[model samples]
Target chain A: MRRPQFSALRERLLRAGVAPRAVRRTIAELEDHFDDVRRELEAGGLDPKDARSQAYARMGSEEAIVASTLARPELMSWARRWPAVAFALLPAPAFAASFVGSIAVIACLGHLAHSWLGVGLGRSPGLQLFSRCFALWILWALPTAAAAVCTYAAWRRRISLLWPAVGIVLVGVLGSLTNFGVQWGTATSRTAISAGIGISTGHLLPPLVRAASTVGLALLIYAGCWLASRRAEEAGSEG
Target chain B: MGDAKALLMSGVPELLILRLLAEREMYGYELARAVRAVTREAISLGEGVLYPALHSLELSGLLRARRRQVGGRTRVYYNVTAKGRRRLEYLTSHWRRIATAVEAALAGPQHA
Candidate 1:
């Protein structure tokens, strides 16, 4: 029995996504098989080429064989984890945390608005608190949505600036509507409006502050995630 | 000829390579040529597919490789080993049983 050649096989295994260590182990096993075939061929008075072909015929389809070898749970797990862990450790976790935190902040702002408007935080008239709360929630959603879309696009190696631009535009429109709504409410109400609270200047300032801060933070997180994604991509390529 | 060659080559390509090396050690390109020649050129194995299969078999402990200088080019020659022979025996025996079963089934009378 003659031994089968393996150097070329190792290269193939690498391209097939087999771990390097596994490739080495598989090579060792194959070497043993080759030795057995060599002995058999020699005993039968067959030339090396004839025996080698006979042995190879028994080994089965290369595609099926490689597929089975790579299908082992541990190897499959390793392959799956490579991309997932690489992406997770990048800006993904940080972005997720920031998004959740922004939602929490928006909830708190809703509470503050309820308290200040003397709407009793929950007993405000005609969906007033609800509308404002919903608006605040949307405000929070704008940047978070942008961040998500951008991060996903970046992960997939696509252009992602659309998210941030759309987010900025949404915020601008929502902010103006909020301001107008507040002004209309104050003007039509009998309640004594706080001079500096919902007045035109005050109304303008709050949304500006919220928009500026949210946009700034969103951009910062986005930039970080983008850089991280790029680094991971480079690392994957190098590997 | 194409169907016959395809059928012969379909399931046990590694065995074919091992059998080739069992006759004589050969490099990757030579092995591919041998397969083509034996099958009367009905089945052409691409390097992309052949190399990967070779690498896999090597990993499976069915083959061994050595570097040799051949006509001024460095060629990696492949050969089979002891364990590979045992596996080949097992696979061949298993295939024989499968072939018998398939033949019986095919030759059996069919109900309308």
Candidate 2:
């Protein structure tokens, strides 16, 4: 008896916006039920091959199961069911979370290094590099990554592109607010890190440029992913 | 006749599921067997098709599912939630009303 391959069905369910857990459980339950039917038929004097065939009949076609599952709109993933809330309305709070989360992650890593390796907390070249990279991550890479994820998810699920674009722009603006600077301390003072969010009217141009660049980067990533997927599909058809 | 029976079987899986689960918790295979037993093999739905019903019911919060390991095998048990009981009540009443109306219509034509 050949094991049932449900990879195609898994992809279909995912693209249809069924929750990941629901899709997995459905596939698992189907496979398990098939096995039980096969066992039962085998116990009733059928050969293994015949049992397998009977089990397939008894279990019904995957197409039937897929159709039934997809028919229930309530089974769809929450994010897919409400694209605006998941992709647009939530990005603001998510941006704040990412900002604070980034800081927390950096602080945790620094603390680990300090405790584990006896490294001093501040005034080292390592600290400077860490702070700079973290600032860049929060201000640019994080937002780009977030937007790129939303774009990819939407593209994968064949969702409308509007929410993802809005998410990109909103996340980009938030990223621009990740203001950071090196606070130079005098002879009796220590080197300090100054990080604040927001830009004054006098210095708005840089933040605006930062936000625009973040959006550009996210768009570039989306285009690259889209092109790659298209090429793969074309190659598959050709082959 | 077979095609008519098939057509009428729409949503029957859900009804049977909720009705049976309202009595006791059962896994998919157990529920499938119980369905056959209760219907005396009259409603022979492909056993595998029950899962979509079960899953959707659970997803919609009409049923609660929990996984248990028995003899090195995992089985998911499902029970009707309070909401499920209420839904079952509504469905049962609705189904009875439809059945009664159809029965009367079929019988009235014969009497005429």
Candidate 3:
């Protein structure tokens, strides 16, 4: 009977993962449509089996039906919500911390460089400019580069071990550079003042403090981003 | 005859099922045929719609299900609980109010 054909179609749709409620609703609508088509075929003197087959052909292919059902807005909306949330919250904090910390470490290094090199290079404009530029690149620019790389790696979920390792390396290198720059700048300026030459310790302190604060902030941001990335991975796995 | 019967049958089977179980219990195919006979073939419900609604109503705690062997086929019977009766009363009263308002509105405009 056509009943078995209808039942088998419904079971196939269900096994393909159509929601039960939607399956039932679609089947009912299809049955109603089939009934009208079947009656017309009967009036034309076609056998019941031929009428059923003709009706099935008119309704279109199984792939088309399944695709149309999945394309429904409500089903798509339900499927996309979790993945979108996981992506947004995952990498934000670590990126912030690394960026802030890199800036702070750079400032601290500038301060130390000014203190240490201020005297030896003061008489030579060419030497002083080169030393200042070199200090800034080593202390500030390098850490910024490292922090950026770490953040990108974490976000992409590639090489899980590399992200934390690179982050640790950046903090250590930048932190030392900052300390060295501050102490150097301070010692150089003190030597200049003691030699009866004018020098600015006031300027150096602010940059040093800023550098230290940046390091702290970057660490906070990095830890936060790392935690968030871990949580997103866990959520993705569970879902 | 067909149009009148169709209008009456559209939602009446659901209401009747609720009303019938307002007293006692019944199984799947039995309920289908009983509903058909009660409406004198005005409404013919398939097993498709009936079973799903029964399951949903059971899930919502308005009804409970039990299985029994009948005519060599396993049949699931449903009985209305206290919650079911309460929901039925709420639905019936609200429906009556809506129906009365609609009827009055349609009749008044036509008569005028």
Candidate 4:
């Protein structure tokens, strides 16, 4: 399969530290210009290959274009200039906090259900199951809430979801790894985590399997949040 | 264009761009064609100069860009802002002043 011409240009611009959103917009605009020129040339009876070459010639040397764009400091996105700091500052802390907050809420509810309600009132299997499901559902809610916040941040910056998406995945990986570290640290108890699938803490999940599952779950949450934020922003911009 | 003429044309691209965009919203390619046509082929803007100028203009809030789907192609069209129009008027007056001075100098002094 033929790779799109613009893909290589996009990669080069990105490698040169151009902002991701600017790279995308610049590539799209240039591609549109080149295609329009080629179309016009072809209509004048030039062959497709010749027309494309002429179109490129009209656009000027590739190096000059790229260099000029890079020279324009205004076009460089904040994230592009300081990627490490950008990833560290944004969405990561917020995501981690949201995840931790969700876990705390789940724990508090679980305690209330088991001690306050179940023992004091009546031991009900349905209430126990409800508590477990609620905990899992709430755990999933953490990523979604983080996604919404990231999306809003992106909109405010007049940027696309590139950083937000990266932030979500990065924080997700960090969270899962932290969980794995804790599990590894305290491997004595046979804790039964009644996630959608009940896994006994005694026979701890294989490290590989657990990591894969964690990453998978994180991805699922990221995908959901990404879609929600995109849709919401689209609706908001339209309104 | 001579070195002197080229040096003098440094800021003309932005002026011409704002002038063309003042007529109607146009994408880069269309604006480029308009520039050449309206200047009677006296001016030709390379894509490099045009795109960067457009971006900087938009950044400075002198122009607004909107992406539209036209005939299945994504085209970013630019329109001059009120500020852009005022800038264009100022540049136009400035250019006319220089032109009048240069024409008088070229025509030689006449006895008053």
- TM-score of each model, in listed order: 0.35, 0.69, 0.35, 0.61
lDDT of 1 by residue, A1-239 (tens): 21236544544555566665666555554554454555566688988888877655544445544655564434322432453333333333444454456545545555456556644433456546655564555455544554445444332333345534454444433433332123212323332221111235546666676556655655666687668655644554454
What order do you get sorting by DockQ, best first?
2, 4, 1, 3
Q: Which candidate tops DockQ?
A: 2
Model 4: residues >4 Å from true position, as ranges? A1-3, A100-239, B1-9, B97-112
Model 1 residue runs over 4 Å out of place are: A1-239, B1-10, B42-44, B110-112
- Which ten contiguous residues of candidate 3 chain A have the minimum total lDDT? A190-199
Put down candidate 3 lDDT per residue, A9-88, tens digits, no spaces. Answer: 45455545445555655565456546655666788999998997776665556555554455443322221233222223
Candidate 3 or 2, higher lDDT: 2
* DockQ of the candidate models in sequence: 0.04, 0.61, 0.02, 0.48
Sort every candidate by lDDT, greatest first: 2, 4, 1, 3
Please give the TM-score that candidate 2 achieves against the real structure: 0.69
| Interface RMSD, prediction 2 | 1.1
In Å, candidate 1's interface RMSD is: 10.0
Clashing pairs in 4: A190-A202, A191-A201
lDDT of 4 at A99: 56
Q: Is candidate 1 or candidate 2 better by lDDT?
A: 2
User: What is the overall TM-score of model 1 with all chains considered together?
Assistant: 0.35
